[model samples]
Target: MAAQLPIPIYSSLEDAFGGLRTASGQSVRWANLAQEFKSRFGREPAYIARAPGRVNLIGDHIDYVLFGVLPAAVEHDILIACGPSMSPVSSNSGSVAAHNLDPRYVPQTFAPMLKSAPLPTASEERDAENTVHAESWHMDIDTKELRWESYVKAGYYGVLNHFFPAAAGSTTTGPHPVPVDLLVTGCVPAGSGLSSSAAMVVASTLAFLAVNNKVVGLTKGELVEMAMENEKRVGVNSGGMDQAASVICTPDTALYITFFPSLSAQPTPLPTSRTVPRAVFVCANSLVVSDKVVGAKTRYNLRVVETLVGARVLAHHIGVVLAPTERPTLREVLGRWLGFYEAKNVPSDLDTDMLREGVQKILPYVEKLRPTRDDGELGVTMEEMIEWSGMPEAEFRQVYLSWVDVEATHFQLYKRTKHVFEEALRVLRFRDVCFSSEAAILPRDTLIDLGALMNESHQSSIELCENSCPEVDELVRLAREAGAFGSRVTGAGWGGCTVSLVAEDMVDEFIRSMKSTYPPYKYLGDDELREVIFATKPSSGAFVLKL
Candidate 1:
């Protein structure tokens, strides 16, 4: 593993965009945002924070299982123009007036309702189990109804609770954050798989950090960790892939992000063949809005519990020992089963071969999770699942169901497990192809193989993970029919967007084909169609700009 460095802060547009060539376009966007900021708030802005949304090129739901995922940061991003509020300084906390260029999201002006809870004594918090707990700073975030500014608040909450602690027993009180006025704008389509939420959270986090002068030495990985925790405040039990891709990605390469042994990322260059034109990814929105928070209990979060519980049951059958209270992910279960857990650095430490083969070897064991019923039931009941885990119902509920809320009468343990293992293997293979220099001669062949993996991934998502919707499935089918190399649903998947691997030369034609055929695109005019779908390249990650 390599040591990750701090995110760079740039002073000029040329440096921010990485070169003068790309700076022209970005300069216009930033200038427009600044102009909007000046009109919205009555002064020149002090700093701008930017975080790009990501398109998961290969991996999907396996990320929550601690598996590595291949995702690239797209050009579409969230930008926050912020400066100190004119309000009088307060010793306790800061206030914010947040406005969005998109009118649908109304402006919000609010402040953190700070409260100091009594800190527990050392012995009072200690237990024989070493389960230590501490009182944390409080901020209310309504996770039920979806709100745009909640993301802004979520970012602020982490900075406040982590950097400015004020427990009752504290000797030194933390300094108050400066009041801020922010104007937000983004091109990343929200509710689509492109990870607009993560972009928003990451940018908001950077904005808060910059305004407070705390971004001086923060590593990109550290920012990713904070954004991951921050997003949970909005009620989604998501994995770290989105935040990692948003914070750690580099231009022209996809990131292979792993959370297992540790959070680490490696940028894998996208392959290109001398025999064929370059390939690009086209993002086509399903326009169905996959709201992770709104559908979490029954959809996204439900799958998470199913996968975790499935791992527990599978581990029990595979003779892997787990603590009675332990809730291991499928990746951890695979490590234990392959005896890689005992290795000095583990399977993922070396190369993808060991991990790929391990997934193939353990895949047959996933059948152990199949329900032992005669009526042809594919899923197991809650009671049956508990029995399979060898844990009491209360304990099972406490370990897996206590923290997150999920609702499902019958859990598809077998399907979820199968999808995870298969998808994990695909991600490893995808990374291998991208890293293979031999691909130079057969770049077209490489694209085909990659596309096949994406196609297979979408099928698994449909049959096993059950995350795709009709609009997404239709878009994928249309993409394939329109000559895309491969296509699949890209995000949390109940509905959002489908990313397709298309030849660079055929992109315009492909978009034309989609518009002529796909129902959603039929009514959209040129501008509306552009907003809903477009070709994208791997772009730079999150950064802060100082004036």
Candidate 2:
């Protein structure tokens, strides 16, 4: 098995800071919040919190299923500078001074804060939820004005509800018990299938805990749980992997993690020599949103797993022990027997012995359902099943047979992915720099190897997974033609983004070609067409800057 990414940590702060310099082009100056606190409250600031956005290079849409995903923190991060608030300082005072005031910062009072500011235009408000805005930040206060910052505030409230419910009782009243005044900022691209929202939630939890002086006492497991609960406040049902990855990932290692109610992370290194190669990943937006497809597929996958689990429970009643993976085969067998029993072409109802034989005939087909090579090929092309279904009978048969062949191919491809990742780990282990290797090496080679896998993955996603759309397919082709090493659609397919690996030397050429070939259809000059091609590398998870 491939090694997983690590859970992020506070100790990685220095390296995380280094990564941020590259991302934001501004060196992080840990806010001298302690000094600011003294000036504001006549006391030292109590705590700090940091959170990072995540990029899924491969294995998109698999994390929520408890399946493995290859994601890492990007250099972009959200840092909260917080301290106890005091009355606003007098403008005439040349020196700053702090005085203790009520800690209760009522959320409802936020409405009045909005009234003090101008309202955003109707169009700006509609896109504000997912897209970033500059002018709108100064607009009227409504739930929407909260934008990215709201996630943090909501998460803080969530933490409060979880840890101090009595204090958060509905009857409680005050300046609305302000937990913290968070100054949030980040560089992670929004709506690109990167876990920007998850980072915000995780970082918010960390900030809340830090302000309360609770981080030092909490165990790693406790931290992950706290972040998970915080995300629940946003109404997004997610397994804790994204938060865990942000919290625990080291510099050069990819943390392979497994989560139940808690988390376990095993850091794996990349394959490389002393001179680690510089690599880049090209993220090409297909201009398609993934909400509906990703959501539906997630639910469907969950339902299938649940049904299989229920089948296993019933099988145990008949004195048979079966694993969940085996339930689908068993169900198929039962279906075949039922089909035989109801066959009008047959003279009579089949006996158990005959039904058993019918099941035997179907077993071969059931077993072949395992993922295949063609699945990987199809994934690359971004094709849909409906498209294939429209083919003529002879062509369909040929495609169907090729599809059958994909099962074995996909099994081999999965094995190949595991082998490459493991070998990369071995290389890092031999270097005796496992920790740094994770921070540096793994991210580079993983992108390269992952790029290769992406080609195959996209092929399979299109052919077998049956989630490809024409626009997505065209984007993949455009990326490859633009000189990407390999390209594939990321996320739940049918449209989202296509992740590509571009050689260092070809980066400029690739960008130029993509821009010329795929010009914006909706926007003209001066409109500042949103960048469709983004270059990224592995980065650290969230953290707080005490500026």
Best-fitting candidate, measured by lDDT? 1
- Candidate 1 ranges beyond 4 A from true positions: 1-3, 89-92, 117-135, 166-173, 272-275, 342-350, 438-441
Question: 187, model 2: CA deviation in Å?
Answer: 2.2
**Model 1: residue 235 alpha-carbon error in angstroms:** 0.6
Best by TM-score: 1
TM-score of each model, in listed order: 0.93, 0.57
Candidate 1 lDDT by residue in tens digits, 78-176: 999998887454233568888999989998887664444443466544332322122255444677778899899888877776676653334256566
Give the TM-score (vs. native) of candidate 2: 0.57
Residue 242, candidate 1: C-alpha displacement in angstroms: 0.2
| Superposition error at 130 for model 1 (Å) | 29
Candidate 2 structure quality by residue, lDDT tens digits, 133-223? 2211121212323344456544564445454443322233322223344444454445455565677777767766665555554555566
